[model samples]
Target chain A: MFGNIDRHTYITLSCVILEPNSPKISLARAGHMPFLVKQHGGVSVVTPRGLGIGLASAKIFDANLEEFSLELSVGDSCFLFTDGLSELQNPQSQDFGYEPMLDVLRSPASLSAQSIISEVMKSADSHAQGHPQHDDMTALAFIFKGTNKILSEYDSIPL
Target chain B: MNDVKFTIDHQSFGDVKLLKLQGYLDAHTAPHLESALGDLIQDGNHKIVVNFKELDYISSAGLGVFMVYIEDVRMTGGDIKLSEMKPKVFTVFDLLGFPMLFEIVEHDQIALSKFTA
Candidate 1:
């Protein structure tokens, strides 16, 4: 029932759909920042161009929208965040930026997702030099450990 | 520093409604924005351009307001456009991937013209 509205007033979002016990993840983008995946001592940014939800007609949005699948192995991790983390400014008014964040992601493979997230947040806070936060900082780190063999074994037991 | 406060100014360019925002847009101020946008939707004025030149900051909560309303406006054959965001303010939206969902222009005039196009 909606008519043609202006496109400027839309918001951007990124969503990841994961199947239980499956390594494959389906990601949909709506003008959000790229998520990063770390594997084999290398980090790759997943940035698929897509229009925002309200910026175009349904047909146009569908035509431009992209969905991609990723298979993660054990010890692989993905980092998702809003700009507040990378854009945090210091006393010199310099932003923390993306490079340092990539460096933070270079943590040892043995580190858990929680540990990596802590390190990332700590680094961002230190970079701020005690300046009061100007924007909200949010992030999610997903570390794949493959299928839970122990749980599977338990499931196989007669109950 | 001044305690964070937000204010909205309503203006019109023919059928397009413009809301100029000043100050920070965080959880506290997000409700005000939602109320303002809601009022516009109620009045059937869907063409909107939110000028953020005077806005100093935006949090995720502020961003959520746009997400909540965009679809409703679109369903009614109208749209909301954003314009004149400061680099910092824009970064917040960008960090959350808003550029993909919204048509962000550098100027109010540009956003205004999109309605005609």
Candidate 2:
């Protein structure tokens, strides 16, 4: 439908469906950045092949689209972000890039999902060096606490 | 003003049209690119090549412009071959699986050669 109405404008969608009370979460990406999985202090960028919406006919788009699944161990954190965050630039016109963004995901385990977002935003702001953002910036993050730990306001906070 | 400077330099090699893009391509500048591609398709010129050697930056919106025309051109026995994309520009395309859908060449001659060979 998008190819008919306005072919030039498109949307990137990243959907994570969590099975009830399970560490196994399924991810579907459509022309968006990959999701980050930080488990055991190692960062993995989970990129399932996907083309953005309105880029091709439904047949071709669906053919190329793929879904990925992974089981999260204790303290596994997953992060989703828009292209705006990684593409954020500083005064020198150099993009903040993925290396530093991944660095934020590698943060200590003491920090909750909330703090991860805060740390990334803070890092991006510092990298911007007073330059205004050029794109819509949005970030969402969540950590699997293994269904045993007491859920605090910080751990369960919806940001 | 949210505007960023973007320019397209056009050249014709036999049946193929080469468009050299320069400067930033964000939401503000995507329409200009869409119209340019639309005009080319309208003129019955589908064998196209886009040189990203000079393009400094591309946003998600800019990336969508290629999607708008790929199917239309491909159905008509032609294709849009992208060439000479800087590492940064190529990285953005790779992020969204564009390389699988489009032919990305390392040089303009390679892209142009694919049209005839």
**Strongest candidate by lDDT:** 2
Q: Residue-wise lDDT of candidate 1 within B1-117, one digit each (tens)?
A: 223488899999998999999997877888889889999889989899999999987766688688767888889778899999998788667644567668899999999999878
| Runs off by more than 4 Å, candidate 1 | A1-33, A39-42, A48-77, A80-98, A107-118, A128-159, B1-4, B41-44, B68-77, B91-101
List, in order, the clash count of every candidate structure.
24, 0
The count of residue-pair clashes in candidate 2 stands at 0
Please name the candidate that would achieve the greatest DockQ relative to the true structure. Answer: 2
Which pairs of residues collide in model 2? none
How is the predicted docking of candidate 1 categorized under the CAPRI scheme? incorrect
For candidate 2, what's the TM-score of chain A, rounded to 2 decimals?
Answer: 0.89
Per-residue lDDT tens digits of candidate 2, residues B61-104?
79878877888899999999999999989988987778878999
> What lDDT is obtained when candidate 2 is compared to the true structure?
0.83
Residue lDDT tens for model 1, A22-138:
877777877777787787668888876576566556777777778988887777777787777877889986788777667777767326666666788888989999877776788
In candidate 1, position A128 carries an lDDT of 95
How much does each candidate deviate from the true structure in C-alpha RMSD? 7.2, 2.9
Indicate the TM-score of model 2.
0.87
